[model samples]
Target: MVRPWIGLVVLSLGVVAAEPPKPVRVPLKAPHESTIPEGPVGEAIRLGQKVFTNTPLHAPKYSGNALSCSSCHLDAGKAPHAAPMVGLWASFPTYLPRAGRVGTMEDRINGCFLRSMNGKPLPTGSEEMRCLLAYVWWLSKDVPVGAEVVGRGNPPLQAPAPADPERGKAVYARACAACHGEDGLGSADVPPLWGPRSFNLGAGMARTSKAAAFVKANMSGLGGSDPLSAQDAYDVSAYFTHQPRPDFPDKVKDWPKGGKPADSRY
Candidate 1:
């Protein structure tokens, strides 16, 4: 029997001819510090950058762990493929599968505090929140309202095998121990990969796939010399993510409408 898809493929000459064009992704970039306007708004932007780079130092009351906003975002949220905030202002209020609702930028930020920071939410009208919004707005000002930016998040890799923690332990010992420590309790400069002081179970980084993606792309830091294979990245990610860390009691509230990711621990 002649299948329906085979007939469509023959009529179109190829699958490429039947598909819609993909959107062009713009390069990720943030304005220079010198370009910040001279006024109260500028002051807010600077403070926001500080908070992002040093969340525990700037927002101690709301920071449950030692990690900062930049711990994951990297380069004050300007670096590509590390979850850059360059085009974020124009991207909300967007729908989130976890929350099962359309959320504003403020909602997203507070979500980070509640989960990633394992801390309390910043009041929408608080100084810290205002400063954060200002900083992100400035960073995203040059981007068009709905333009797609390349390297916005950690791009996933196709692992040759399913993630394996035993293999990951070896990868961590060889590649990560020097900086993150054998105990996984990172130093004052580096963020801990796992432990009570690290991000809680609810944080996105808690997922093996998310952590693997980030590790594969930027394991050491910005401009790292060595890169790991997809399997190594997955293995190391699985090893660390399965280690003990703070738990999110409210995790039951996530994915209220269903669509919970397969990698979710709880």
Candidate 2:
């Protein structure tokens, strides 16, 4: 009992369907170290890399904790999804909701010092600041202006249920304690996860969701391992973020114009 409509449907099936569009991600590219220009500019770039990889050693005056910039940025800020700095130059002079104003690259860098490092802001014209800017600019040469890179920051995650610190403690002991230590103080090579040396309450990582996203993506250590489930990530993040750490007095000034995330510790 074939109908005329059935013939039309059969004909339609012969044509192939178009493929769905893929997720967009800007390829991260940076100039090779061998190509760094010879002279003061090159010197600045080199110094900047040193500062970034070992902030406490290279820029001791501004370091208030044991953590280096590479502790968070990872692979000298070249690694994606771990807050990579590649393509970052183009996105700045952007709005910062926390500060309630447009912030330049310098402001952004200083903000990390104030919150993440629990240290003081670098003077805008200081040598350390200039060198860091030059390094970032060199890294951003390949990216187009006014473009947004997909992996610029940590990916967002939502837990299925409320985060449980007790469950997180178990997860941390099994997975994280090897490198970070049971005390959370970490050794000389590893950055502390909590206590006075960790990021202050004002840093973005203090938020449960932000930390979970980071842990889910990158917390398996340099060799890499199986990724954590969203619930486990959320739970572990909740446990560590609530641990005692430095305080940021200026936190009160944040979100002045309004629009603070619900996860903010303050």
Using all chains and alpha carbons, the TM-scores for the candidates as numbered come to 0.90, 0.88
Model 2 local distance difference test score:
0.87
> What tens-digit string does per-residue lDDT give for candidate 2 at 1-266?
99999999999988899997654556766568897789999999999999999999988899888877788898898888889888889888899999999999999999998888988899999999999999998888777786667677787778999999999999888788888899999999899989998899998889998899999878844334345788989998999999999999998899999988998998
- Backbone steric clashes in candidate 2, count: 0
Candidate 2 error regions (>4 Å): 1-25, 221-226
- Which window of ten consecutive residues has the lowest lDDT sum in model 1? 218-227
Which window of 10 residues has the lowest lDDT sum in candidate 2?
A: 219-228
Against the true structure, what is every candidate's RMSD?
5.6, 7.7
TM-score quality measure for candidate 1 = 0.90
- Residue 207 error, candidate 2, Å: 0.9
Tell me the lDDT of model 1 at 230.
92
Clash pairs for candidate 1: 81-151, 168-235
